[model samples]
Target: MNDTSEKSSPRPRATILGGGPAGLMAAERLARLADVHVFDSMPSFGRKFLLAGKSGLNITHGEQLEAFLARFGEARTLLEPALRAFPPNAIRDWAEALGIETFEGSSGRIFPVAMKASPLLRAWLARLRESGVSFHARHEWQGWTEDGALRFGTPDGEATFTADVTVLALGGASWPRLGADGSWTPFLSARGVETAPFRPANCGFDIQWSEHLLDRFAGSPLKSISLSFCGRTVKGDFVVTKTGIEGSAVYALSAALRDSLEAGANTVLMLDLAPDRTLSQLASALSAPRGKTSLANHLRKKAGIDGVKAALLREIAGKALLDDPAKLAHAIKNLPLRLDRPRPIAEAISVAGGIALSELDESFMLKKCAGVFAAGEMLDWEAPTGGYLLSACLATGRAAGEGAARWLRRS
Candidate 1:
């Protein structure tokens, strides 16, 4: 009477569609509980993740839990549980377990000690493989067959897969070449799963730039500045792109500016050229009698504004405001830059507005499609850069993976 229950029972099959952070994470979680398979449309996995780490992967933020969770904006409450379970410290520890140590930057953003994504990703994939997770590249998910089996368009032909649980981490429409093209929207919609329209997040905005400014400062960096929009102010630096403004500071305020523009409101990004100095102090300094000093020279000497910052003032304020000390000071303190529109979603760092939160259960399983879970940028949420995007993606991926495992166990 030897026990044969273990030999008689087979592990459940779990399929993860998409090989980005979320999909990989889901596969990792399900590896132990089920036969995990990760499928990606791209030829290889983690294209976007590798590119993101090209300049040193900022994996997560080193902020307090409250502050860290608040970065998700309106999706905070929905993502709180997942984030808490796999917070920044956990991210660092997990990376360490993968042989990739991490460090905190001056701004409290976390980065790998190796400063490259390839090493960490390599280790992660190896671990997943060791745990019996299989990888299928060049398999594009094409919704489901009539009988509810997963259908995929492969290079050879169409293929179908059946899984006890499915996790879709197909990401949002940003960096399309990196495999997150938001093509899964229509498929999910056909199944009655509500999704929000995709919009650019952490993206640059277009501005009507003068020829002079474009020629001189098209690729210049505006350092030590503060950008304000709709009463929210962020102190950081950004680059002056040929089309408009972008970088950390602009990305920080892009959500509000993009929303205001979309709402038909006149969106203006106010730049504090000299954030360290007070408005009254600037006014008093500019009021000094100029002994044949050039206006640009005066601004440079009195207010410490030069280079791209000075050119921005000239481009925006014109000569009328430049001559008056009070007006110049006010302009310096609050220089309004009218934005034309946001750069296309393809040019964005990430995307917002994915599967509506209401469509998913507490465990991240789709209420409409049982055993199907959504995670990562495919969910309706947006956050600034500085490690927030990756943090949320990994957390939600883990959550979806765990949820799928739990669902399989219950079934």
Candidate 2:
């Protein structure tokens, strides 16, 4: 029997590929009406998820869903319904229902009281078991069967699985060792799905610095600073990495800068050293300085500037700007930095490209291929970290699951 068809016979079998959050979410959603089997290439589910929990499992933040939905940019409309159906509040509520009560941190990001992703994942896995979802681990996907069945590379060699529908949540190219290595692109292309080239998003940019600046302040941090690019602004801390700058601020603007760099444009990342300080006030303060003291010492002692701020001023503006008080202060208010290139996509926390939206139906089902759906980071969209990744992953998983469920009914 053809796998995509909905023949009137036995219960439809739904196979969810990849065992990350999206795959798991799809399994849970499909189990209500269909026989579900989730397959993962890795030894276990949620390897990268557990790694994220290694720091602390930030599941979702407590911000309003509207603001959270806005984070997705162009993908917002496609993701809105699913997100609204199961939002941050619902996510926290669902977590509480799963025996893992959550709390909002100072940053408004929500996490389990235990503060690790593993415990919640374990609990969720146990729940999925009770919900009757099955898992097939260590089964690397090997594209289509000769008869158009789903084929996978198992430890024993190769095996073909038959299913009524298949949902590919195979994630993006980032964090490949943890399982989502983007090995499914060729398979999708073979099936006639248009794929965009995967690029770095939510990744750092490279900035070459002189040895004098590098050695003096390699790991220094610029705290409580505001950064801007292409009309978007974020207030956070950024660290001076060995290659360039990274951290929350840089990651927030990464998508814009990455796009600019990819287009061969000279991307200018502006930093406001004294975000809260007015140019006039800073000028007055700088002018009152110099009691035979070096400029660095005076700036540090007078303006509470240290670490990356001082290094940045020294590197970008030099001592001439410092000599002219008003100009130096204004420059501090509007310091410019050039971003030459983006870090490798492999090192990015998440990625920016995959199957384009034009290739998918309203149900997230592949337009050309019936009974096949794609979700999570595998879709062509990008958003920064801080729970946005996890939230959308869950939403799209549910969307695909519900779509598959409806398709099974029609079949």
Candidate 3:
């Protein structure tokens, strides 16, 4: 016998700045109840995501939680809760719901079946639109106004807006051309929110390569090699760039190397030219060298070290050691190449050092600035490639979205 209709009222507005994966995910979650709006500096959204998928869209890793969690390093503890709640399985499921089928590669890195981000992004945008979410492109966030309103510079002119809650998914300082330029750092810092200086991550380091080696092997790939630094070893292929070495293996240890350089310490990357052969085995093989064969030929035939690998060894161990089998074998097994400095942040894949974790609550909302949440590379956490970065971004975005909804409901 109770017939009562709820009073009509304006829905709470949730604004998500930066239309990357993190911002998009937050908008998706918040659109259920709030008037969600996603703003981006780019012409459209997900430019970096598309670029990442140019090779293949490594969505997430299919490894066990323990191993996958360990990849976050010092931020592992801070990120475990978000990741555990929405782990690899959750990511695959979310993609599937968007009609984007994904599969695990041989390396256990997950990717969409199409292996491109365009289809997935198109489908995602459609879904967000259907969910009552709005998009504003080329509206570059220019920090906040004196009255605490979100300010953006648009093609037409400067615009301002106020939202019940805001989720900042502005990415780090990598790929500035793609829109994540780390311009939001000062905004939070000015509000007494602590932040770490953005630094390169998963990037190349400069080395003193002789002009000869640089010219010959600058673009060559050093395949099936092992690189170790700071007690961490990664077995993968890397390319010899004109400045230094870079690729999967080098990037895996980029954080440690970049940190070392920041601390003003000399850093060395040890490359095992022939990882398959033991040091003793290499010595024994070299000891039985030909009587008149050329040193390069002898190396290629006996130890399978030639081309760029041989050049790298000579670059580090010198030609005199090539005559000494024992020393040459040791050098081949542990060729130490000192790294000068990390490539500029513009060239990094992602970046470390952002809004410090201490500044945000467990829900990813800034404690000092209530109703303001942050996610993605804007936060001070870095993980190597192979999908760790994207997973954390998605998880934290979801957390912020759910938190924003709750905060708005309470208000």
- Number of clashing residue pairs in every model? 0, 1, 0
lDDT for 335 (candidate 3): 93
> What digit string (tens of lDDT, one per residue) describes model 3 on residues 76-115?
8778998998999999999999999999999999999999
Candidate 3 is scored at a TM of: 0.95
Which candidate leads in lDDT? Answer: 1
| Residue ranges of candidate 3 with Cα displaced over 4 Å | 1-9
Better of 1 and 2 by lDDT: 1
Instruction: Write candidate 2's Cα lDDT for 1-411 as tens digits.
Output: 212323344777889999999988888889988878899999999988898787577888788777888888999878888888889999888888888888899998888889888878899899888887888898888799768888888778777788889999999999899999889999989988999989988898889988987888888888899999999989998988888988889999999898898899989999999898888888888888497998887787767677678878878988678788888888888888898799898888889889998898889899989999988999998888888898889889989999999898998
Candidate 2 vs candidate 3: which has greater TM-score?
Answer: 3
Candidate 1 vs 2: which has more TM-score: 1
Off by over 4 Å in 2: 1-10
- Pairs of residues clashing in candidate 2: 6-411
lDDT of 1 at 381: 95
Instruction: Supply the global lDDT for candidate 1.
Output: 0.91
Per-residue lDDT for 205 in model 2? 83
